[model samples]
Target: MTATRRAAILIGVFFLLTEIGAIAARLLYAPVLTIPGYVLGSGRDPLVYTGVLFEVLLVIAVVGTAVAAYPVLARHNRAVALAYVTARILEAAIITLGTLSLLTVLMLRQQPHAEPGALETVADALLALQDGTLLFGPGLALGIGSILLASLMYTSRLVPRGIAVLGLAGGAVITLSTVAVIFGLYGQFSAIGLVVALPVFVWEISLALWLIFKGFNTAALERMPRRSVDAAGAEVAS
Candidate 1:
């Protein structure tokens, strides 16, 4: 297989890994999410640790997707590709900070005679940080990066135009929804927010599966300017 195709598949794999981590964390953290005191309770150590593990995996996956896709995207537009990579890196960093907060909560819980009120306050703050990261990292950064990358794909025909359109639209909707939530129009995880985010979720997963199973469209690749590809590669390397 071509190197570019392999990279595409790796991106899909990493994307899938990221989703898995998110799902697993949600399931494991369900009981603890709302109950600030739950972090100190008995028999929850494994759950907390496992959830943190998944979150670490998430960090890895987020960065991996961007790094893997950089070359292919750079082939079409070097500046946009670099921006995408930067966005993804920022996303990963924000999420990593969130993960560290969770770990801090865990450490606090381990201390003997820890103050319940202090634990609760710290936990609440950390959760708020996580929520903010979701809004800033995935909601804003991911949306913007997806739009740029999807546009490149559409213009270059790297993927089907339909998928590209879905991505562009989904990204815009999510970004807008994020703004509404920030303005207090609704909660972050509210029904309206989920509805708007559904498209981007679908677009990413569909794009992932397509890349894994079908790879890029060679016809489209041929149609792209050779000069553009070479220039982008040089830019990335530099």
Candidate 2:
């Protein structure tokens, strides 16, 4: 297979990994996120550790999607492509921070505490940090990055226009919904949140499957190596 074809497959695989890792990590983190005083409770440590593993993998996958897709995107619009990568990095950094907070929660349980209820207080604060990161990382950064990448795809005609449209709508919806959540319109993961986020989820899955099976509209990218795309009013010989 050609290098571009292989890159498309790699991007698809990373997208699928991001999906699986996200779901697995969230479910595995239930005890810490939901149960009361999980830092004080015993058992289920293994599950939490497994969740950490999933999240670590998720962070890798999150960045992989942007990196794998960057070359082709840069050919079309270097500035937007760079912006997408930045957004993905921001998302991954926020997720790492959230994961670290959870790890700190677990660590707090092991260490001895002098003040009464201090463990619970600190654990609760860490848990809150985790949630806040989720709101900004997956909710905000993901949305912005999706829009940037999808807009490149849409304007460049590198993929089916219909798929690109879905991505555009999905990104806008999720970003707006996240803003509402930020204003206390609803809880993150509430019914409203799920409804607003569904378009983006579907968009990602569709894009992943398309890349894996059909690949990009290679006709448009036949000269991809030259970085001579005429989209977005940008042109370059680099």
Candidate 3:
């Protein structure tokens, strides 16, 4: 296999692994958190630790996927590749913030003997930060990044336009939902956001599977840009 093709395959595998890890972590999280609360009166520490570990793993998986995919993207289109990298970095930052926010919330919840005024205010602020991070940060980054990456992939002939369209729609939903949350429209619209996000997650997982199992047709990859150049040259000569 060509180096580029090999890189693409590896990147595809990483993407698949990341998604699988995320799904697994999500599945395990509630059960683990509840166990501490149900069994022991003070499962708070265990739950928080588990949550932190899960978030750390999630961050690693995301970063690893981005690094693995970098070569393929760099080969196809530099601008798009940079954008992809930037988006992933932004995503990492969002996740980090989210993790920290959650940790803060956990700390506040686990406080043993409460203070009077200042500590209470600090805890309230932390809680607000947690809410803000959860409500907006990751979703915005993920949605915008997905749309940008999908557009690049479609334009570069790396994927189907339909996928790009779906990604674009998902980005729109995410952005709108975030706005709604900021504006205090969190009742019915938040549910709609969840509904919209489910298909997007499915689409991404399917795309990752296709990329890993089938790989891209290298022949098509080679022909696309060359044909574009040849056509352009012909126009110039005419």
Candidate 4:
């Protein structure tokens, strides 16, 4: 297989890995997230640790998808491809903040005879930080990046137009809905919020599977801009 094709496959794998890490970590973090004072009660530290590991890997995969896909995508539109990479990196950074907060909570819990009242307040603040990261990282950054990348794919026909349309639709819905939530029209964790997010979730999964099984459209590659002005005022083509 060509290197570009292999890169597409790797991107697909990273996409799936992100999903796995997100869901598994959420489930594993329930004890600390849901139970009151669990963080200081000799709680399920190991479980939360596993969740942290998953999230750390998730962050890696998030950046990997952008880095791996950039070269192939840049052939079509360098500006948009670069934007997508930037968005993914931003998303990863926000997620890293969330993960670090979780780690801090864990560290606080491990302290001998941790004070209950103070610990609870600090834990609540950390949880709020994680929630903010989720909202901005996945909800805003991912949504914007998806829209940009999907627009490129649609115009360039790198993948099926239908899949590209789905990506666009998903991004629009999630982004707009997130804004509504931010404005206090509804709670972010509400059922309505979940419903609106379905499209992006499906879009990601469908895109990942297509990349893994089908790779990029060859005709699209042939049609991509091959010549451009370099920084040194030299014309170059590949």
Candidate 5:
């Protein structure tokens, strides 16, 4: 298999892994997020640790998906490719911050004697931080990054134009929803939020499967110059 095809497969695998990890983490953290002040004194639960682990894995997968596609994307337009990777990494870092906040809440809950009011206050603060990061990272950064990458794909014909359009439209919708969230027009994960975000979810999963199973269009790829790994480890195209 070609290196590009191998990278496409890797990206697809990690994209799915990211979704799985995110869902698992959400399931495990449901109690803490739903129950106010639950994080303050809720006895040590192994599930919290597991949730944090899944979140870390999600962060890794987020970055991995972007990096895997970077070389192929850079071949078309290096500037936008770099921007996309940077946006993804920034999103991952924000997610890591949210994960750390959750872990910290868990650590606080494990303490022997915690002041009830103080602990609750801290937990609330952390939770708020986590929510803010979720909106900023996944909603904004991810949306923008998807748009840039999808635009590149559309212009270069790396994937089907139809899929690219879906991505672009989905990205725009999510971004608009995020703005509404920031303005307090709707809650995250609300019916409206879900409705707005669903297209992007579909776009991403479809793109992942397509990349994994079909790879890029051969005619499209042929129109672009071929890139090879040189002895010095740089991509050199002739």
Candidate 6:
């Protein structure tokens, strides 16, 4: 297969892995939370630790998928590829820190026989960590990254304009919802965030399928206008 075909296949695999990872994390959330509660018999420590593990894996998968997309993006649009890559890397960092904060909360909860004051202190620390990392960091990074990727794809014509627009909208919703979550806004908005995320998920899956099964339309690329040559010259050049 050609280089473009190879890149397309890889892109498809990346998205498929990402989708699976998202589902896995969602499924694990309940189990992870129940573990701490089951162990402590009275507290929610097990649940917290399980959440930490879930978040960590989620971050890893997201980061990995983003990284995998870089080569394909480079082949499609070199000018915007670096920006997309950078945004994804930064987003990954934010998730990593957020996961660490969650882990910290879990560790604090693991104190087998602590005083009330100690437990209170730990709770306070956990709250602070959650606010700083989970509440703000990952949300902001992912939001901005998603927007950048959307814009890049749109401008580069790497994918359908409508899909790119959907991506941008989805990113905005996620970012705004994160802010709302932090500010203690209506609880229903959280569900709205998930609703907004659906379009993005669909677009990614469609892109993956197109790449893996259909590959790129080489004839279309060949027919596309070339800035370096006039129509007549371009035809001859080809």
Top candidate by TM-score = 4
- What is the RMSD of candidate 5? 2.2
Question: Over the stretch 48-90, how does candidate 5's per-residue lDDT look in tens digits?
Answer: 7888899999999999988999888888888898999999999
Q: lDDT per residue, candidate 2, 87-179, as tens digits?
A: 999999999999999998887777654343888898999998999998899889999998998899898888899999999999999999889
Better of 3 and 6 by TM-score: 3
- Encode model 3's per-residue lDDT on 171-230: one tens digit a residue: 777767777767776642367767766755765676676677767656547754321225
* Reference-based lDDT, each prediction: 0.81, 0.89, 0.62, 0.89, 0.88, 0.61
The reply for model 2, stretches above 4 Å from the true place, is: 113-116, 223-225, 228-238
lDDT of 5: 0.88
Query: Candidate 1: which pairs clash?
Result: none
User: In model 6, which regions exceed 4 Å deviation?
Assistant: 31-56, 75-79, 120-124, 131-138, 180-189, 217-238
Per-residue lDDT value at 51 in model 5: 88
The per-residue C-alpha lDDT of model 4 at residue 152 equals: 84
Q: Return the TM-score for each candidate structure.
A: 0.90, 0.93, 0.74, 0.95, 0.93, 0.69
Candidate 2 weakest ten by summed lDDT: 222-231
Could you give candidate 6's per-residue lDDT for residues 1-238 as a string of tens digits?
8766777677677667656754654455444333433222344545455555666666665676566666555544555667766766776676567556555555555677866576656655554564465445445666666777777666656666776787788777777877777677745226765675576677667767876897655654454443245656642222
Per-candidate clashes, comma-separated: 0, 0, 0, 0, 0, 4
Q: How would you encode candidate 4's per-residue C-alpha lDDT over 1-238 as one tens digit per residue?
A: 9887898799999999999988988888778789887767764478889999999989999999899988888887888999999999999999999999998888887777767898989989999999999999989988998898899889989899999999999999999988998999999899999999999889889999999999999888887767678899975766
TM for candidate 3 is 0.74
Instruction: Give the lDDT of residue 42 in candidate 3.
Output: 33
**Where is model 3 more than 4 Å wrong at Cα?**
17-44, 107-124, 187-189, 223-238
lDDT score at residue 14, model 6, on the 0-100 scale = 68
Candidate 5: which pairs clash?
Answer: none
